[model samples]
Target chain A: MSTSHLHPFDAALALASSAAGLYTGHTSPAYWNMVGPFGGITAATLLQAVMQHPDRLGEPLSLTVNYAGALAEGPFTLQATPVRTNRSTQHWTLSILQPDAEGAPVVTTTATAVTAARRETWGVGDMPMPSVPAPAQCKRITPAFRSEWLQRYEMRPVSGALPEQWDGSGDTSLSQLWLRDAPERPLDFCALAAMADIFFPRVWLRRARQVPAGTVSITVYFHAGSDLLATTGSGYLLGQARAQEFRNGFFDQTAQLWNEAGTMLATSHQVVYFKE
Target chain B: MSTSHLHPFDAALALASSAAGLYTGHTSPAYWNMVGPFGGITAATLLQAVMQHPDRLGEPLSLTVNYAGALAEGPFTLQATPVRTNRSTQHWTLSILQPDAEGAPVVTTTATAVTAARRETWGVGDMPMPSVPAPAQCKRITPAFRSEWLQRYEMRPVSGALPEQWDGSGDTSLSQLWLRDAPERPLDFCALAAMADIFFPRVWLRRARQVPAGTVSITVYFHAGSDLLATTGSGYLLGQARAQEFRNGFFDQTAQLWNEAGTMLATSHQVVYFKE
Candidate 1:
């Protein structure tokens, strides 16, 4: 396989070879998180493995990723296995392993992807889109945060802005933003899956300061087909995320992503491990 | 391994023996769905495996289960593998395998569980509890539906009632109800996980009709700690569920579970495969 013609996302997920589902890829400094590669890109890379597999059946309907350990800055190996294939759906389990000092494989990440053959059916959109300025009217958030991953996405916050400093007086943990790939790539399932996780932690919105918080697990349900995303093209997506409850050093956030046409593209939920 | 003194919830998850993190359990007819055991019970059972494992750390933060195949009415083997164990968190991958006619093991279900050592933290509840009548004031829904799973739980629908028949004319896909175990068992993580999935499909609520619908994947994030659940006891839990969108043979639903005191217990989301 040649690498010159691939998009940035595809290039980031490029595998060394298809044999044994082995992938050796370096973390792009462009999408680097504070500790490791951005979780969204890591998630996208995992899904991309299945999408490129020879036995893949359909597009991803749902994906769940659990961040177990931190990844180093060098090459990492990913192994994706098609665990089960039904008549109309396929299930895959993937793991990202990084060797430790002892030369033993340590699982850094794990994920489950469900793909299915979709057909036209009764359709309805019950969630109303939040009224926000169009991407053209909104100002792009400057990269004032010290995160490379934040720099990879153009975010226009319509409601909740990142706290200026550690002020614990904010009342609401809701954020509505217009987001897209920084370089303006067209929408696809892989990119959409990654975009689903671009929201800042809800706790940060409630309290202005950074806590020791990280997402333990995240689940995404894709509601739009590839055709819908293709039609959406390289356009900004309207996203709204909020936490329902925060307790016992943990909180859960729910978010929905929609295109400019108000078509719901995906709904995502995750639980974050936070410290007081 | 004495089942005689166990709660029904515990009895349903009773395993013969756990060796090398493997568990063997049978499907309880009390919680049977249309075909196999209720998806909720199956999910709870899988989580129970990890809860009982010796290597398990902390409490369950999030769980995701994917139904790959149907479970036969017999014994099933569950393998819980601790893929990663961090300082304060652990990740597990589980599979429910049942032998086919030819005696080859076939994976029927797969799940991921994240557990962490939780500590008290600055907390807030952003989602307001739905205003509904107290459980004592509401009438319990008698078992009119054919599902044995429905008979196993007492439901008091405050808003959307199951339509007498499928007519495809209802307007909205919202259901608000008070739900509890039939025998009035004390609430716990396993029971709460099961309760998260007890809501009927939102399509049925809107259409006032039934179509072939099955959940492909479901995720639940536990918000209440053991102390809170113990204090809440066997009281009915207020629940509200609704779908954001239904399109292309699939739909996504989000639900929240809360105690009578307006404390959120868990938040759940799922994607269902529906045929028109």
Candidate 2:
């Protein structure tokens, strides 16, 4: 029950409820991005607020997070409102607010999530896991960059590694890799949500140019439930990401995560803002 | 302007302003689905509210709509709130409220959209348009079902046509088609948004079983601007869609739209609830 004993992932997601649908949380240095905390962890924290809500229904089926603005260091207020609850599904709208330069609370992030009581049904995985060398055979990426968030994830790039040369001549944008939490945390909806955003901007690799890029919006669809995630445990997940188009200072990329057992756990898509 | 002179698409999206961030709209029979107005049209209507807003900034970058409940055949109240407005992008939270059986307004649909002033930058189309016959060469599909919405689009399926049998024996879920407005309306974001959801439930095609299915959440990323869309005019767009996974009564699919010149227009993804 103590925050000190929790994993960094859980610690970063820790929230204290002061009123109905209102939660207070803090940023973690371990998952800090260039300007703020990683968007994925922020997404997970918002989902955690909803998960802890007393009026929560079922589990997370889909989540969309919008990074409206940068989150400052220290505490922020998150409001998770269940906008609608149906017989089998519930919809939630969440927003995170932090003080602006003018000493007024302003929205830093916005999100919408759907929770549903899943039922047994005919199941199928249309995308087969990409064939790649096992995690042991892959070389772990040692970040030369200053992103604190990179150090939080144990990533083994199988292809499309950050450009060996930033000459702006790259042709392909595809990247397949094995990834997991650095400290080895068990898989869950929140953690999976965080992992869904692990891929760096696909434009960087596709153009082989070191341009500024950040995720503007990210959406994740969970295909597996708690049981399957529990079974997946702390194992490395195979992730493949690629961009469909990069135009007008924006690009969208989609990625899929699968367990070592080759079962697809989640699929995620994001639109990124880039400066060329 | 009178509604009678507007195109059917514009007529279906017609909204009457009541107050700041609030409007009222009715479901058009021209875009009616099996139980309600087509989900794509509903999405476009919500986006339309923002486009018509006095405080709206820039063009649409991304939109995510959650179908919280079935929309009845009547007028519904729509609220579009710009929760945050950055220098380049604006975030909006929108919801549709309609009277339930007890005559009290309830949330029927909820959505979030981002509008941004796009800038010139390095651009590329990573996902190539699949080579297919021109719209003139492909045979236009005649509706075999009673859904009024089917008649609104002129579809020329190149692959993954609806099953010829109702037996549960199917293989792949990929569908490629050339689609355009039935009455030859000009290309625009609203019509493109509606066309994004034109693909029928992939589960039916993948399983060859006509099970009940409906979209729960849909997200679209706009890749082309109004200028480019205007260049596209009323020509058919090449669309390709496929399901990634189906499990626990839900499945997620991804789709891409491109012009005849091989330029990617938009990419859309959705999570659908299906009963098997």
On DockQ, the leading prediction is 2
Q: Which candidate is the best by TM-score?
A: 2
Worst 10 residues of 2 chain B by lDDT: B1-10
Pairing residues by index, what is the TM-score of model 1? Answer: 0.97
RMSD of each: 1.5, 1.1
- In the range A117-236, model 2's lDDT, one tens digit per residue, is 899999999999989999999999898589898888899989988988999889999999999998899999999999999998999999988898889999999999999999999999
Return the lDDT, model 1, position A31.
Answer: 77
Best by lDDT: 2
Give each model a TM-score: 0.97, 0.98
Candidate 2, residues B123-229: lDDT per residue as tens digits? 99999998888888888889768898888888998999899997888999999999998888989888888889999999999999999999999999999999999
* Residues A1-276 of candidate 1: C-alpha lDDT, one tens digit per residue: 576776666777777754867777777776788988888888898888888888889889999999998788888889888889998789888899989999898999999989999898888899989887888888888976798788778899888878777778677888898999878899988899899888888898787767878888888899988899999998989999999999988998999999999989999998987888
True contacts kept of 1: 0.88
Steric clash pairs (candidate 2):
none
